[model samples]
Target: MSWNKLLCNLRELQLSGTLNGGQSFRWEYNKEMDEWTGVFSKTVWKLRQREEFLQYKVIGSLLQSIVQKKNDVEFDNNGVFEGLLKKYFRLDFNLSDYYTKWSEKDDLFKAACKQFYGIRMLAQEPVENLFSFICSQNNHISRISSMVEKLCKHYGEEICEQDGVTYYSFPDVEKLSTPKVESELRQLGFGYRAKFIQKSAAQILEWEGEKWFAGLQDMKYKEARLELMKLCGIGPKVADCICLMSLNHLEALPVDTHVYQIAAQNYLPHLRGKKNVTEKMYSEIGDHFRSLYGDYAGWAHTVLFCADLKKFQQTTDSEDIKPKKRRKKT
Candidate 1:
């Protein structure tokens, strides 16, 4: 249960309420307080996620939140530590099989998969996830994250400050389900996504809407994803992201530009030439990965996605690539 030696690179994990599909966050540790506080946990739950192995420090509030939430359960470092370890590292799907198959060709990809992509699981919060993905359509990460932050700051409650940083809690249904708020968000630069987020929030706040979302909880993976797609700003890819990350549907595949690139060069070469990517093609590509890697389709997606990102960064002329210096033994 003691995780003093377990996790490292705490920023990689998406403890934030919104899943932007990009692993970029803003959290700084307070050495004096010895507590990690931010909008989300911002604690790296997976230890083997990075090339360098470092000691994992326990954040007091995050552990306390879990303990306090559980009825009749007392707060103990051991119990809290164990709960987090299980939550992050314990995979319902097998990784060994996926890793072995992926590692066959490129050793670099294998290492990238195991180290970076493997641990970066999506934590999807239904409403927030829905809006985040909506914000992501035909948009960039920097812009998407900024828009999300704007919405949260404008609409969400100001929880408290930690180390001079003000962290805004995610807005609830009540605050977001109004026409006035939706209009304000549009003015704040959400553009098309603002309308969808506002309408979706309004629907979720409705009486019948609760039942609709509740029903999705017990539905099958495909059914649940399909149901989510009914909401405004919910497309096939967006719905799949919500299902896999937030709804606990492990096999869900959310295709985007990066995944499309992988499908072209790596997976399906013939489909690469298509000018427009259709639903049938996307489903076929998902099936291909599922068939080849079996249950680790999501895992493979993460691996390939991260590998593609790294390759893209390396090849881009805008960014400078420098050699990584080796750390000397302590």
Candidate 2:
């Protein structure tokens, strides 16, 4: 397979913000080389953005960790790679127009947009979104990424080997459904999430495979979430994530702990009077965004969420003054 290079306006597309912005977390950034290596669509590749010009190398066939002379497949200056990148990043959509419109809607959203300006929601694969969110329960971004990478390396087919390092694709649903897969994940420190991953895969298999997950894209947001809830470990939050990121449910708002705080501070200030937000409060927050931001509510909520995460990074990380309560994910 050949890969193509896409050079675009830096203001509209920034790899540091979009890739490192923390939506889908499979890409591994090599600081020394200034490159990011990751697998998507079952192909392993390397990319580096030089100002406006995006350079790439398609080191094909994930099944081989060690590559000889002939086995190496390369992609360059072709429609195949260009189409893939366009579809992956949703480049057809003009994000600047969205930013302008969203900023006009609310002052808070306006402020958040200013901070993480070029961040765009990625259209992740359904299987990857399903299992990745499964691993995300009771976990943070960094660990969630590690667990996802481990799942790929263990069950996925190897793509290629570079500098003694091998990259693999995300494991297939059938490959992940067996009893042994859950056991392997347990040993890999998946903890309680191991059960969720295996059980979810089993449920998908019972539904007659990929079409079950594919059909989700055609359904309404509430309906899709209900169907997703049938799988183990998928709650309102995770369901919303799968919907918004991959299933084209742009209005879905994943009310995680961070969003809960933002709601308490800004939109739902009545939440301050209570110890924790109830189900009613969660619905209120999601509904609030749905009403305010309209169609692209999910996209707006994502930038705000990332902005909130960035805010926490600048805060002091000491717990000496007072005891902290573990706020459950709403």
RMSD of each: 7.9, 4.9
Candidate 2: which stretches are off by over 4 Å? 1-4, 62-77, 312-329
Where does candidate 1 clash, by residue pair?
10-44
The residue-by-residue lDDT of candidate 2 on 62-109, one tens digit each, is: 423333334566533345656677777778789889889888988998
* Local accuracy by lDDT, each model: 0.57, 0.76
- In Å, residue 68's CA in model 1 sits off its true spot by 5.2
TM for candidate 2 is 0.87
Question: In order, how many clashes per candidate?
Answer: 1, 6
Output the number of the TM-score-best candidate: 2
Per-residue alpha-carbon lDDT of model 1 for 1-330, expressed as tens digits? 243544433333422211212522223334353333334432323222233323344433333654567855666665566555545434333545556676774564566655453345644445566666677676655566577778778887665554475556667777888899777987898887788888888877774655666677688888998777677777887787677665666677776655766778876888776766677887888887777655546655765565445544432221121110000000
lDDT of 2: 0.76
Q: TM-score of predicted model 1?
A: 0.72
